[model samples]
Target: MLYKVVSHMLEQEAVVEAQNSTQAKRKACRLWGVSPSDEWHGISTMQARKLTEKERRVAAVAIKHRNICLHTDEGGSTVSIRNTATALSVINQLIGTDTGYFG
Candidate 1:
């Protein structure tokens, strides 16, 4: 997707294609200055590590909402999540998501 990279100067922006928004931010940063934050989308960047094979599998995609569960191969059980943002943040940590303050 083509993500818009806007600097503090709003008027100073650039467009670039990337696998995800974070990648876009990185590319924008390379252009000179671009600060990336989860607040970019009014969201916070989630940090997560693999708990098992299934967690690994879950990390492969983006989960938009919370209150969802995902199963892994190593475990014969499922894990229930509470918050959507936290879960998504975890998933995002594995795969980049644009948590910027934008829509």
Candidate 2:
């Protein structure tokens, strides 16, 4: 009976995972500059690793949103803005990368 309960829980978790993946795929599809749905849908284990790398890259760049700079002007070029890094990260996430540095 305990085994059956554990098995049922595992099955339910799998179902939830599938649903989450589907939702993620749909979201990725809606995003114009994101990976194609085909790439995310029915993803293989290798592809899952790739996706994880992408997510890490995104997270790394997202750190820039908290950046604060001291400049004569608030919106001056002297102020460091990491927008480029963020964009690069997003692009890398959209496309698979060979280097695992993103991880």
Candidate 3:
């Protein structure tokens, strides 16, 4: 959710993200210098948008990648694919983009 810190009297606004509505509102109150009774009201929650299939898949790949270095490397995280671009291509195909890149 997006927490909006809105000051109607001062015409000021700030935005923040929190796990739940209450947390967002509280943060917004502090940010906009409002005490829940001030004429300058602050704190409004907006619903967050869900990620699409392509965006989710792209994010998943961007988050983690295998250590595809050739030869015996000292540190290796995962030994799945051989290269990052190759893996991205394969993931794109599975996600229906088929751009051969992180598209």
Query: Highest lDDT among the candidates is held by which one?
Result: 3
Model 3 scores a C-alpha lDDT of: 0.44
Candidate 2, residues 1-103: lDDT per residue as tens digits?
A: 0000011211211111123454533333333233342433222211211235444444344444533222233352222336744443343342333333332
Encode model 1's per-residue lDDT on 1-103: one tens digit a residue: 4344555433344444467766766665655443445254211232212134444334323333333343445544334455544554444332333322212
Model 3 RMSD to the real structure?
A: 13.5
TM for every model, in the order presented, reads 0.30, 0.28, 0.31
Error of 3 at 7 (Å): 3.0
Worst-scoring 10-residue span by lDDT in model 1: 41-50
> Which residue pairs does candidate 2 place in steric collision?
none
**Per TM-score, what order, best first?**
3, 1, 2
| Lowest lDDT block of 10, candidate 2 | 1-10
User: After best superposition, candidate 1 residue 76: deviation in angstroms?
Assistant: 66
User: Order of candidates by lDDT, top first?
Assistant: 3, 1, 2
Give per-residue lDDT, candidate 2, residue 33.
36
Clashes per candidate (backbone, < 3 Å): 12, 0, 0
